[model samples]
Target: MRVLLVGAGGREHALAWKIAQSPLCEHLWIVPGNPGTATLGTNVDLAADDAAGIVGLATREQIDLVVVGPEAPLVEGLGEVCEAVDLAMFGPSSEAAQLEGSKAFAKMIMLEAGVPTAAAHTFDDPAAAIAFVEADQQAWVVKADGLAAGKGVIVPDDGNVAATISAIHELAATNAGTRLVLEEKLTGPEVSLLALCDGERAIPLIAAQDHKRIGDNDTGGNTGGMGSYAPAPILPYAEAQALVDVIFTPVLRTMAARQIPYRGVLYAGLMLTPNGVKVIEFNARFGDPETQALLPLLKSDLLELLHKVATSNLADVTIEWHDGAAVCVVLSAAGYPAKPRTGDVITGLDRLPSDVLSFQAGTATNAQGQLVTAGGRVLGITAVAPTLREARDKAYAATELVEFAGKYQRSDIAARGLAE
Candidate 1:
């Protein structure tokens, strides 16, 4: 089977790596893929959002399946376009993708599905939002209604309603739409659980925990993802299955009832609080650093699994995972999550051990033909081992081998998992 994977990020690189390993995959291609993905397959020059260009390539190449890695294209109706051509694409339709595209829509669905989540209120008027925050007199998470990468939501520090108000103003002024959703801040260790769906059935993947903050010890602002560890100790396989029954099942059933059945990956950002497991957010596609870590531990044929999901036959195949654990540490450029500095020459990748995998995100080839940083979150260094401690240590050791100007990383990645 010939497959065309979309997007240019560490997630796409990991997907390319896993897909290339499948014996069923006859050929592989990535659109606007990074320098790392080039080693795994042919990197096409077309943009991921160019629906017409992607369709033309798929038709011309007679691609067997289309696997999307990012959420932007999925939210832009790429899956619908693929359906128009009878092309098998693994992703949710535009309507179903509202689960990620619009926070207000997700909140509404959660409310209707009886899924446990934070109490929230949507406001279109900034004044009304500020009034609500002031009246509540408690810490609130201010989120932009539309997509803002992974940094859309802002959590005020320690019940500082002033900060919350400022965040509301900031999001209202900067975001394209002034709409906002203010949610009651819930405290707990977060978990990332992804499920593969076929518009009817859902299969849960290994649970992962992502470090969203840019600084160590959960300080500083949020980023796309700093690092992650798979099979989170908090939620084992049996526990994760129970979470699926409580979270993914109702959500999928609700989506199907809406006549926009969800296909592809349904990523639930969960908060394991004292009250219970509550959802933090929903992503239409795979998580970045989480994918970098989780895919390395998957023992099943990724191509077959994705094809089954795209063709609405997910129940035909069973999922399998390695007993070992995996960890990913992201190397970010200077001033990341604000104003990242790029164009710095990178070196020392060839010195890494064969056991470690380096999936590139923000990278490019300069005139000197040297790899350089091109985005905030640069490379994801992943390592798999028999234990989470070993995996975390191995991943951090690999991080020391790579060198680039203004390169930084969280020193305490997977610390919570190790504590568990």
Candidate 2:
């Protein structure tokens, strides 16, 4: 099957690497892919959000399947664009994508579906948000209603409601007209579960734990993702299935009932709170660094699974995974999650182990034809092994091989899982 994969990030590179290995894939193309993806397939010079342009290319090329990798385009109606041409595409429609596009909308869905989540209130006025925070003594979470590239949610270090309000103000400065969602913060370990859906049926992938903070021991600011480890033993397969039964299934049914049947990945960011598994957020597409960590353990043909989901034949599909753990440590530019400095030359990629896969996120070929930094989160060093400890060790070791000026990575990825 000829495929056109969208986006240019570590997730796309991982998807490109995985899809290119499938024998069913006759040809692979990526829209505005990074340097790493360019090595895997034909990279088109088209922006991911250019809906008309993407559709024209897909139709003209007669692409068998268009696999969307980013949430931006998916939220902008890439699935509907494909539908217009009667082309097969793997992603949720724009209406269904509101689950990620708007936190308030997702909260409403959760409330309607009886999905367990934190109680929250949305505010368009900053003063009202601050007043709400001041009135509540409980620890709170302040989130930008719109996309902030994973840096929207702010949890204060002291868990002070006032501090959270301050964070909202800080976040709102650059994100003009920002709407805020303030919720009572829940305490727990978090897990990311990505499920493949075909309007009705859903197949869950192995649970992954993502380190959203930029520093070790979950300190510092939130980034796209600093690192991640898959098959989170904390949320085992049986428990994951229980989550699917109570959470994902109901949510899917609710969406179907609303006339927006979800078609692609349903990423549930869950918190294993004292009560039970409560949803942290919902993403219409695959989680980024989590995808880098989890895809390596996927033993089944990704192409076939994606096709099944897109074609609404997922009920008959059975997915398989390799028995092992996978880890990914993201190397980001200095001052990342803010104003990241780019254009530094990168080196040592050749030194990576055969088992390790270095997926590029923010990198480009400069006029000098040198691979250099082009974004905040640059490289994802991923490794899979028989044990989580081994996988974590290999991933960190691979990070040492890759060198660039001002490159930084979390010192402890999968540390909790390894300690366990």
Candidate 3:
């Protein structure tokens, strides 16, 4: 089968790598992929959001399946465009994608579907939002209703009501046509549960934990994702399946009842609170660094799994995973998550151990034909082993080999999983 995977990030590179390994994959193509993906398949020069270009390419190339790696294109209705052309695309439609596009919409769905989540209130007026924060005098998680590239939510310091109000004003002034969803702060270790949906039933994958903060020990602000580890000991596969019955099943039933069947990956950002497991947010597609970590442990054919989801035949497929752990450490450029410096030559590609996998994200070819940093998060170094400790050690060791000017990474990744 010919496959055309969308997006140009580390997640896309991971998907491309997995797809290329499938015996059924007769041909593979990536739209505007980075250097890492280029080594796996034919890298098309068209942008991922160019709906018309993607449709034309799929038609011309006779691509059997189109897998989207990011949420932006799906939120922009790329899946709808593919459907109009009678193309099989592995992403939810725009209406179904509202689960990620609009936080307010997701909150409403959770409330209506009897899904467990934090107490929240949506406010369109900045003054009203500020008044609410001031009256509560409690720390709140302020989130922009619309998409903000995984940096939309701001978790204020405990008892910092002033910071909460300030965040409200900042978001109100900057996010146009967007409201604010202020949620009561929930405490616990977070887990990511992503499942393949067939518009009727859902199959849960191994759970993962993502470190969102740029600095170590969970300091600093959130970027896309700094690092991640798979099969987070906190939520094993059996527990993850039980979560599916409670979290994913209700949401899927709600979506189907509303005549908007959800297809593709349904990612649940969960907080294992003392009270119980509560959802933090939902992502329509796969998580970034989490994908880099999880894909290496998957023993099943990725192309077949994705094709089944796209065609509503997921019920016939049973997923399988390796009996080990995986970890991903992200390498960032100078001053990442605020203002990242780019165009620095990278080295140590050839020095990575054969067991380690390097997935590129923000990279480009310079005039001298040298690979250089072109975005904040540069690359994801991943490794798998019999234990989380070994995987973490291998991944961090690989990070030392790769060098770029002002390169930054957290000293501690997968530490929580190791402790668990």
- Tens-digit lDDT string for candidate 2 (1-420): 999999999999999999999999999999989999999999999999999998899888889999999998988888888898899999999999989988888999999999999999988888888877777765678888877778888887565766886787886774622777887688988899989999998889999999999889998888899989989989898778767788889999999998999999999999989998899899999899999988899999999999998999987677899999999999999879878999999999989989899999999999999999999999999999999988988888889999999999989899988765
lDDT of each: 0.93, 0.90, 0.93
* Candidate 1 off by > 4 Å: none
Q: Estimate each model's TM-score.
A: 0.98, 0.97, 0.98
Candidate 3 regions with alpha-carbon error over 4 angstroms = none
TM-score of the candidate numbered 3? 0.98
Model 2 is weakest, by summed lDDT over 10 consecutive residues, at 171-180
Angstrom error of the Cα, residue 24, model 2: value is: 1.0
**Model 3 C-alpha lDDT per residue in residues 1-420, reported as the tens digit of each score:** 999999999999999999999999999999989988999999999998999999999999999999998888998999999999899999999999999999998998998889999999999888999898888888898999888888888898888999998888878876532699999899999999999999988999999999999989999988999999998999989999888778888999999999999999999999999999999999999999899999999999999999999999977677999999999999999989899999999999899999999999999999999999999999999999999999999999999999999999998999999888
Model 1, span 70-153: residue lDDT tens: 998999999899999999999999999999999999999999999999999999998999998899788799999888899888
**By TM-score, how accurate is candidate 2?**
0.97
RMSD of 1: 1.0
